[model samples]
Target: MNPVFKEFKEFVNKGNVIELAVGVVIGGAFGKIVTSLVNDIIMPPIGALDRTDLSGLFISLNGTFYQTIKQAKDAGAPTLNYGLFLNSILDFLIVSASIFLLTRAFIRFQKRQVEAENADKICPYCISKISINAIRCPQCTSILEETH
Candidate 1:
């Protein structure tokens, strides 16, 4: 039991685990934000321009008119809520785009870090700062191992 508890604590304390938990929470909040953006901000203007509320674009299997989607679902009506689906699709696209852009930025930052780290350094043989130069080291009689 103590070992199990210790293992659990270690698992929770791990950087990846903590990051994953934070990501999940942030992702949930981001999902809600995207949903609101799609429903309230983006879709509203589009709906206004198209002359139709997305919520109203539902077909009932039975002959029943619903003011809202919640009411339609509550009344046990089979509805084809294509407009809501479109809104959801837009939300997904926005989220996907945001994630893609973030990942791309992260990758670019990592590449920059790597390039900075792997930049010109002093040659071990020559003791001179060189940008991957010196096939034969200038100061010493050693051939550079970097060159074939």
Candidate 2:
């Protein structure tokens, strides 16, 4: 095999690189799901309350009025699609909140794992793992007492 190809293969075979590739794929799918949730599930009620269709909101730059964005586009009028911008902002917020929640949950899980692994008490004098009920440092033969 060519040396460059060999190096490329090694790079691609790395665990981090593989994990990153998987993350990218999953992130794309997750983004679509969040976008749908924002557009389909969340926005309709808010739009209804405001008596506005957010995705159809825009201003025609041609100094002509159109009932909707589609109408303006069909009439060959330039438009400032602020309603679509609002939808994009909503998508961003939803994605951000979802990532925040997942990160917080992952942190909590990691903390629990660490605590479980460190459940056994360590002897301060000998720096060895000791039973939680131990009254002496077994390795150094030092008496343990309640200092506080």
Candidate 3:
């Protein structure tokens, strides 16, 4: 095998690369779910409240008036589709908020896992983390008394 091909094989076989590939697949699926939620579930009530179908909202640039985007397109008028833009903005906000919440939860979970694994003690003098069995604070070089 060529040296470059061998190197590429090694790189592709790495755990991080495989994990990233899985993440990409999951992210794509998650994107579809978010898009559906925005279009079907979230937008309907908003459109009802606004008394306007968001997808049909547009402004004609040719000074020709049209009731909806489809009408404007049918009439061969240039339009600014602000309603569709609004929907896209909503989708982005929803996806961003979901990712933020998930990342925050994951961080909290990781912190708990780390704390559980360490089972260490904090030095009273220096407030530094040390082994639970340590009799002295390594950071401050202070003697530690055993607490019953």
Clash counts for the predictions, in order: 0, 0, 0
lDDT of 1 at 7: 92
Q: Write the per-residue lDDT of candidate 1 for residues 72-137, one digit (tens) a residue.
A: 899999888987787778898999999999999999999999997677666786587666655665
Single out the weakest 10-residue window by summed lDDT for candidate 1. Answer: 139-148
User: Which pairs of residues have clashing backbones in candidate 3?
Assistant: none
In candidate 1, stretches whose alpha carbon ends up further than 4 angstroms from where it belongs are: 65-75, 123-148
Clashing pairs in 1: none
Provide TM-scores for the models: 0.73, 0.82, 0.75
lDDT value for candidate 3? Answer: 0.88
Q: List model 2 lDDT by residue over 54-120, tens digit each.
A: 9888899999999988899999999999999999999999899989999999999999999877766
Candidate 2: where are CA atoms >4 Å away? Answer: 122-131, 134-148
- Candidate 3 lDDT over 18-120, as tens digits, reads 8898999999999999889988998889889978778788889999888778888888889999888998898889989999999999999999999876878
Number of clashing residue pairs, candidate 1? 0
Overall lDDT per candidate, in order of appearance: 0.82, 0.89, 0.88
| lDDT value, candidate 2, whole model | 0.89
